[model samples]
Target: MAQDIGRVHVIRHLIEKSRDRKIKKMIEKMMPILLVLAASVCIATTFGILFTLVFETFEFFQRVSIIEYFFGTEWYPFSSGNPSFGVLPLIMGTLKVTIIAMIVAVPFGLAVAIYLSEYASGRTRKFIKPVLEILAGVPTIVYGFFALTFVTPILQIFIPSLKLFNAISPGIVVGMMILPSIISLSEDAMNAVPNAIREGALALGATKLEVALKVVLPAAFSGIIASIVLAISRAIGETMIVTLAGGAMPSFDFSVTGSIQTMTAYIVQVSSGDAGYGTVIYYSMYAVGFTLFIFTLLMNFIAHKISKRFREEY
Candidate 1:
């Protein structure tokens, strides 16, 4: 019995030593390659997407002038005589929808985050957060269908001219789609505020609301803003909901009641139909996609910069 016990101890020590050495070597070997691999993957993916968009966009621009694509008000590439290829209308439509979405999402998302982080009990927060995440996990196509089938009809009650697929419903749904992202991020930021700060605020005789609004919120402002910017970028890049719900007609008007097409919607419309390669219509999709890609990229870069500059210290 004594001999066996000694052998087991020796074996366990050997195994522990082996594991420690293995883990240390793994970390040492991986440390350098980690950043390189990350950068390489990012560049590769960016280049792949950018290259395809640029070449296709270049082909598109050959048929359509840069000026026309940028400043043109009408977008009817399929129409006959005097077809206008102005991309401004589509840009305006995208902006209108995004603005509406931001308006709907930001306040509610931030409020929910504050409530969850500052007010909710542990049990309530645990339950509510999963439910919120589930909201995000719902397939966007379902939301698109809901917008088309339900939201538009509801809007039609107030606005007779509202089409089967309009910006209002989809924009609202897109806002809902992005709400969980914003809330989750913002709550994380809020929760990162040190307990000492909260206690100090309470020590100063400030109410919970006052402490949260004036102290904790300010401390976490950078993270909250970063979350908002990221959410905006997400809204701009959203495709399925906008495509399935927003009507596929690119227009220059800023009216929410009117049917308008986003950059993503336009791409989907073109890609859905049969257009042979090397055709103007085919190239046009690339050009629109390139434009959308650049727009989203710019937003992402800005958001990244903001996040880096304002990321929480601890």
Candidate 2:
């Protein structure tokens, strides 16, 4: 009887093992289908957005002259008499803030990235990296309010010409908001440089700083440029900080201390129910969004090209 019981137990264990193998095979077969479904969702969403923007922008152009909209300098879409729909001022505002943000973020971000990748000890990097990432994760609305209440006031102390709502404060805050992207991505790129290269340079009597600047930096150039481009795209799409702190006054002036309205800010204003649905002003929002979309797409394309062109093979 004991021998018969052992035989039964062995048979049951073999059956269970076979069933587990079948389950594992089934899961492996399902993974590709699941991944394809996820990719399809993303593709569908992108097309949906593109179609919406195109349809609405077409409607806007039917009512407003495309030539005037593109080349006209005035942008008073809410005028009581004749509302102008020129996009130049909005474009100028967007570019001004973006330029200022790049100016502030690029140098500082690259410097910090170099420091973290080349000089920081493992423990120090662990602490500092998380802090920078946390700063990045902080809500943009908070940054907007910080710029409006804090930075603007501080700037006013130095430059009495600074307005309560101006591009400078928001530009600086946006720069701070995008710092983590530049720092984290650039540092990762720098770290990806082979240790063998560093050793080889050092063996030839190259100093650490020299190796980092001349050798590692050139090797990581593509990644750093891609990171900067991504940051520029983020700065362009930033809405709350520019809307709240950069003011709602659209202007062609490039002065950093002047109040300006970006394409996103104008979209916010139009979408805030101030313009009735189906009004030309409401349709103008789509036009602005489509324009913003084009700018971001161009930036991404440039990043891809630069990454591909300058990428270094291991």
Candidate 3:
């Protein structure tokens, strides 16, 4: 009887071990599928939101002509009187901020990246990198306040034509906000350049600046372009800075010194408390959002193309 009991215990232990091994193997086999599902979640969510926006936008356009939505010159959806739904001024406003931010961010960001990658020592790079990228972590509202309270006053002195809530201050602050992304991504790309390439350039008597600008930058150009496009996308979508620093005036003008409102700012304005749900004005928000979605989607596609177009494994 005792021998039979001992044999039964041994069998139970073996069975438990076998079960555990099978479970582990099953999980291992499912790992890739699980990762793919996780990736697909983002795509699914994006499509879902896009579908919702399109459905709502189509409904809005049914009430207002598509031509008026796309080409009309005025946007007064909340006006008590006749309300117009023209998106051109909003598009222009978004373009103005984006262009100014790019103009400020591109050269400055590339310069900083080059200096950090080529000239800065270990300690300097360590100290400066975090401090610079820290700006990215700061809230957009805080930057908005800085733009309005701090930068605007200074600009008013230099360009007296600049209004209290002009586009220039917000654009400049957005550029500063965008700087961290450009620097970090550009630095990563520059660092990824083969050290052998740098060595060859130096062996040929090229200066550090020459190697950076001519050799490393050209090699990392695709990544730099991706970073710039992504930065511009962020600038176009930014809300708090532009809403606070840029006045609520939507105009067809492009002057940075003048007050203007971006698409994002207008969306924020409408969604916050312009009208009740199911109203034409309320539906206009979705139309604007859909337009923004298409713009950003195109930008993402371009960035993807640029990145995939070239590969240097060495």
The C-alpha stretches of model 1 lying farther than 4 A from their native spots are 1-42
Cα lDDT of model 3 by residue, 184-290, tens digit: 98888889898999999999999988999899999999989988988988998899999999988888876778889888998898888757888998889999998
Model 2 alpha-carbon miss at residue 5, Å: 26
lDDT of 1 by residue, 194-236 (tens): 9999999899899989988999889888888988888888888
lDDT of 2 by residue, 1-314 (tens): 99999999999999999999999999999999999999999999999999999999999999999999999999999898999999999999999899989999999999999999998899998899889979988999999999999999999999999998898999999999999999998988898899999999999999989999999999999989999999999999999999999988998876889899999999998888578878899899999999999999999899888767756465
Looking at candidate 2, the ten consecutive residues that score lowest on lDDT are: 305-314
Between candidates 1 and 3, the one scoring higher on lDDT is 3
Which of the two, 1 or 3, has more TM-score? Answer: 3
Each model's C-alpha lDDT?
A: 0.87, 0.92, 0.89
TM-score of 2: 0.88
TM-score of every model versus the real structure = 0.85, 0.88, 0.88
Provide the clash count, candidate 3: 0
Candidate 3, run of 10 with poorest lDDT: 305-314
Q: Return the lDDT, model 1, position 94.
A: 86
lDDT winner, 2 or 3: 2
